[model samples]
Target: MRRPHPASRPAPQLRIKPPRQLIAESGADLEGHGLRRTMGLFQLVCFGVGAIVGTGIFVGLSDSVAKAGPAVVLSFALAAVTCVFTAFSFAELGGAIPVSGSSYSFAYATLGERTAFLVGWCLLLEYGVSVSAVAVGWSQYLNELLNSLVGWQLPDALSAGPGDGGVVNLPAVVVILLAATLLVRGVRESARATAAMAVLKIGILLLFLAIAFTAFQAGHLSPFATHGAGGVTAGASLAFFSYIGFDAITTAGEEVKNPRKNVPIAIMICIGLVTLLYCAVAVAAIGGLGADAVGDKPAALSLIVNQVTDSTVGGGVIAFGAVVAIASVVLAVMYGQTRILMSMSRDGLVPRVFERVSPKTATPAVNTWIVALVFAVPAAFASLDAVVNLTTIGTLAVMAVVNVAVVALRRSEPELKRSFRVPLYPASPILGVGFCLYLMYGTGWATWLQFAAFLVVGSLVYACYGRSRSRLVAPAAPGA
Candidate 1:
């Protein structure tokens, strides 16, 4: 066999990084990443729920209900099951891979550098657009709350953003900026805010369920399967976006206390908790308000409250919850985006700027700001659904890839210490990959176009930069 000439040799970064090497890099102490390990299981759980239960439930539920009618309850169930399978993959990887890049980091450990770049690129889409989507949801609910409490509404020019019509989404921009400011402060502070928001939003959903049950009518469920199987499938695919944030727990692996144990447990617990809340809310909305009413209602939860009590005061509470939910989601998604970028930077896939952490805050301050800046543009200018489908498509693709990585690692790294393991082995990971692909196909063609375009641009960036600056290439080497 002839070796390639040195002149024709591919760069070292183009080679696969060994799992043990990735693990050793992650296990380093005071590596100057400036990230602090401080989050406990409670905070990790809060981050998961805070990210999982937001815009999808608050602002986007009507979209799902409209797509599937009363069958949206079933849609939520299907989406939840799909998420559970993926969550197991995440659990095992999170326990085994000590990096903070979430799936991006996992892919690097199990797959290779180029694959890791793709995963991180997809994550950038998933997290950044998710933050925008959640912020838009917050704006919608905030408008509802203002109308209910003070009898005022911001006209579409100010409330709606680019694709939605206005020059900019002022409210969404405001909230994104607020979350970025909080992130600039520190991670612990961010977790505290997340916990508070989680508590309030969960209470709000429980309250909606209680009030909705009083007005629940069996007749409203007459045509539970309105759109039949097809609509339910579409709804499930869109509903999958809600669970996008659960895997975010893995991104905090570097910051969480006892990450090997805590990260996996948090991922499962967060998925389970969010699933129950989603199902209950769906049942309450459909049974009490009927599918048609739920679809027509802009503020579904608030409308349910007003229907039960026939008063704006009750609507106010539900609207408040939406506000809190959207705010928390934006914060958590931003956190995930920054951590992934930081991890990529540590590996030299991107500029080192994103990896630098603020010594004072013990957070990736610059990276956090960059993320907020990146998403704020879309939040301010783009329409709500403009980026929603793109987010889902990218996420499903990454999840599918992560599932593949799980199977790959099972055979290649059997001796690695893992605090959590995927039960049922091959079946679970295979199902995870299947579920993600099924949902990806469910996403519309336009979304696939957007996703493809984004990856093309990402590849260009990588070819120009990652090909040269990757950490795998030593500075002393002449051909580095």
Candidate 2:
């Protein structure tokens, strides 16, 4: 008896839609037609620094130092190496696509519709959580500054967020709302403000390195890898959060003139500049303040500067710089988040609320406020580690997708008129994937669990609303 094979049955029809076909159906265009390309290499570097040099440097330096001792320098280098690979992939994709949504747009073009949705979802965690985290970190430094200036400080209960021992993070919330207001005004204004802050931050970091180096003690270098190579790697993973925003320069590709040449140049310049700055600071701090001392204080660099010089002047300068720096971090990250949401709305992943631009401001007013409120509250009181960890995981996930996108695009669309191609093709992207994966593993299991929950919730939302409402799935009437 010949049994009928299961292969004889017809293949089931997929509820899934073709990705490219859907992209063609969506009326929204990715490229900006007439936007100004006013950003020069200097401005672009500032933009990258504005996004990258945030509370992470001001607050996270101590944490990393504590984890890896003098080896923290190696950690920064490890993180920078990982970032360089990802940055190259980003440069190639951003130049080719030049779209509003950075990774989300890339994933849609190469991966598929569902993968695109997932990428956007992960970004929400990256950008949204990070904004809140940065805001909260700002509040701490602000309080520190106030105490140093006056004899008094804000009540701890009022200063902190829900998890940090306070009922609410009033300062963080206020800063977020203020940033939202500024964003509602315009991108140019926001960028200008951010640029000023970036300058102050770089100045502060340089000053710290210079002063710390004056007190450098070679003896502190003894027992360098006290925590071993594994600990140093773990610290590097944590330090990766500091490098989060360099790719943001690419997100502005459509707005830049000569994006092909300028965008790639900006990414390399920005990464190189930041890495040099971080290395200088790390080496100086470890030399001046024993790695053991570095771990004992929250504001390690500032504390070391004060201890080395025994001057209130150093602390004042560092605190003021931190205030300016963190403010810019909030502004830049919120800008990135709103833009991501706008891109998603255009593609029908989320509600049209994300797409609504205020006639008064020409920005996404409602979306800005919504994002501000969501991030502000938690940022006020939660531990910086928790928020930063979430951001790192989300960013790693996005980077992984980008690595795949680079390879897939090459094989699938070999002649897509890419202004920049990631040199060494398969090898570069594979290295990028490996770097991001290693960092992703560094995040503890708790963060992974939270990330998983976020994805599951996002998937449900897409299934219930986004899938059906997708502009590409149900094409509009010809004359509607």
TM-score of 2: 0.92
Q: What is the lDDT of candidate 2?
A: 0.79
lDDT of 2 by residue, 341-373 (tens): 877887778887887767665577888888888
Candidate 1 achieves a global lDDT of 0.85
Clashes of each: 2, 2
The most accurate candidate by TM-score is 1
Put down candidate 1 lDDT per residue, 98-182, tens digits, no spaces: 6787899778777877788988989977898888888888889999999999999899898888577777789998999999999
> Once superposed on the true structure, which residue ranges of model 1 sit more than 4 Å away at CA?
1-14, 28-32, 475-480
Off by over 4 Å in 2: 1-41, 476-480
TM-score of each predicted structure versus truth: 0.95, 0.92
